[model samples]
Target: MNLLDYVLPCLWAFLACVGFGLVFNIQGVGVLICGLGAGLGWLVYLVCVNFLTGDIFSAFVAAMAIGVYSEIMARIRRCPVTGYLQVALLPLVPGAGIYYTMRYCVEGETQLFLSTLLHTFGFAAALSIGAMLTSSVLRALLPKLRLGRE
Candidate 1:
């Protein structure tokens, strides 16, 4: 894969997240934060998928990256992490999987539909679990770190 192969997707993800940020009424730096989070997440996803064996695992890693990023950004900016995290995850969502699954169902391809549906669910679950896991860990650890510093 050439540089453009990665650059283009990250760019698209950034723009898409920026657009969503605008639509969600995020102003100024918040919009930029959302866009950057998405771009970074996509880059992580791409890197993981290139080296990893499964797309689900890749999504999980990417989601964790995004989770860490969004949490840090939230702490720095004093804003809720939900907005940034939600928009950042959009690119990794299994849009194609859902579409293909529905298409197969409509076409009466039982086997294809079932497999696609299950895969889509798995991918979605991985993304959620990855992000949640990171957030939970950080929440559990940050207080301890602060106490240690004090």
Candidate 2:
């Protein structure tokens, strides 16, 4: 893949995050910042998937990136991390995977259903683990990182 691959997806991710934020009534610069964070996270994921590793690893790192971005920005902006993190994380959600997995199951395609279900669950697990790890790692280094302080 070339620059277009990265640019287009990142742009789309940014727009999606922005729209989600708006629907949540997020105001001011927070919406734009969260959108940018989501875009950057998606860009990192794309790069990881295309050049470095599989979807699990890509999701893991992408999640970590978004977590770090949200945590840091929340401190600087004097807002709740959830305000940004929740919206920012939307881009990485495996909604399509979940839909297809359920669809296959409903259609009684045992083999495809099982495969999709497993993959979807695994991807969700990766996202959860990545978020947990990012928060844990950041918490451990909070003092060193000098965040969450005036």
* Local distance difference test, each candidate: 0.92, 0.86
Query: What are the TM-scores, per candidate, against the unseen true structure?
Result: 0.95, 0.92
Model 2 CA lDDT for position 44: 85
Model 1 residue 2 distance off true place after TM-score fit, in angstroms: 0.9
**Poorest 10 consecutive residues by lDDT, candidate 1:** 141-150
Estimate, for each residue in 1-150, the C-alpha lDDT of model 2 and write its tens digit: 778988998999999889989999999899999899999989989889988878988999989988888878877887878878888888788999989988998999999999988888888888878877877787788868666642
Residues 3-114, model 1: lDDT tens digits: 9999999999999999999999999989988999999999999988898889999999999999999988888877888898999999998999999999999999999999
| C-alpha lDDT of residue 31 in model 1 | 92
Off by over 4 Å in 1: 147-150
Identify the candidate with maximal TM-score: 1
Please count the clashing residue pairs in each candidate, in the order shown: 0, 0
Model 1 pairs in collision: none
